[model samples]
Target: MKRWTHPQDFIALIVGVYALLSPLWTTTTSKATTTMVVLGALTAVLSVIELVRPDTLSIEGLTALMGVLFFISPWVMGFSDMRAMSWTAWAAGVITFVIGAADLRVTRSHRGTVATTL
Candidate 1:
């Protein structure tokens, strides 16, 4: 088993799980539930892959993309009127995006440093 190396990935995993479970507690239409489940699963799976292989830079981009999808899901999926669900998506999406972007920056900088030193 791969060791847990990144706290950001762990947080993202939590966010994914939350998103997956949110539809149960929140008022959701069929479309909203489907969107949440699919996006949440994608986020969770990507986070796990990142946790296992932190060097996989592409995963960060994918995660950020998931965040963007999540953020816009309320409007696109027609759930924007549901204040609680909308807020949840907005908050979770922002959090996921920041984590992915920040991690991507750090990882790239580290790579640059290594390349310079080598």
Candidate 2:
């Protein structure tokens, strides 16, 4: 769990990059491409912000929401016809969700000590 601290934001960042580039390697529709790139970019930006300000747990939740969006995007964006793209979306979504949740948990765990210090 020690390695699963705020620095763990790196997971989301990497996942974000993977999602963003997936369209390049896989066959995806315009809608799916847009969805992946937007959400991935947001995840990367938020993770960087979280790294700078450890107290920004909300960013973790936002990233998690982005993950959820990624998971549902194939259906929502009407790109399910591309099986490869859909699989990539689902897999990336799950990985991104896990990373964000882990980061949130780590941040919350440190909150008690931080409260006392304040």
Candidate 3:
């Protein structure tokens, strides 16, 4: 069996794909699409890194969390209209952030086990 569970892998894979494609479906005006695409790309890249190297997956959650927060900043801070991009951005951000937090928690909990075995 693999170190990471199937559901974890699937979720990560799906999220990574979504992040990569978000920019294509959304508007690109005023750098909005550019920013979203960049963030999504980052998430996808990091996820790939995690999949290939479980030992280095420690920061996946952090990356995801940061990406989501960055995506929602415009509306979260009252700088942009909530209906235009805020809701979608916020939804993406929250999901990514949760995934990141979960990954961080799982990675942290497993660290002790690995250490004790060493």
Candidate 4:
């Protein structure tokens, strides 16, 4: 069992699980479901990369942006009236984005300790 030691990984793991399950419970389908699943997988991948490397600004930024997109997908797509599930998904997205951003900031601030020079 790979123990998650980073916030990004924790968030990503949560997002990934949600994505893998949303299609079955959210009562949503097609494009929306597909997009959520894709974003979830992306988050998980980026989180793993951050765990291994933890110094790539580009990946962190991209992950955060993707998180934001997921958060607002329901609203922007006019699906706000969906249900608690949508709200929870959006909330998870926002939290994931924040975690990614915070990881970047922490890495930048503690570059000497966290980010290794290659």
By TM-score, the best candidate is 1
- lDDT tens string, model 3, 10-57? 465566567556666664355565555666666666666666666774
Which tens-of-lDDT digit does each residue in 1-118 have in candidate 1? 1448788889999999999999999998888889888888889999999998887758888888889999999999999998988998898899899988987877778789989999
Q: Which ranges of candidate 2 are over 4 A from the true structure? A: 1-5
For all predictions, the C-alpha RMSD in Å is 1.9, 2.9, 3.2, 3.8
Residue pairs clashing, model 3: 61-100
lDDT of 2 by residue, 1-118 (tens): 2333465688788888888888898887789889888878887887777777767547778878778988998899998888998888888789888887886776676777678889
**Which candidate, 1 or 4, would have the higher TM-score against the true structure?**
1
Task: List, in order, the clash count of every candidate structure.
Answer: 0, 0, 1, 0
lDDT-wise, the better of 1 and 4 is: 1
Q: After superposition, how far is residue 88 of candidate 4 from its true place, in Å?
A: 3.3
Mark the 10 consecutive residues where model 1 has the least summed lDDT: 1-10
TM-score of 2: 0.87
The ten-residue window of minimal lDDT in model 3 covers 1-10
lDDT of each: 0.88, 0.80, 0.61, 0.70
Model 1 TM-score relative to the real fold: 0.93
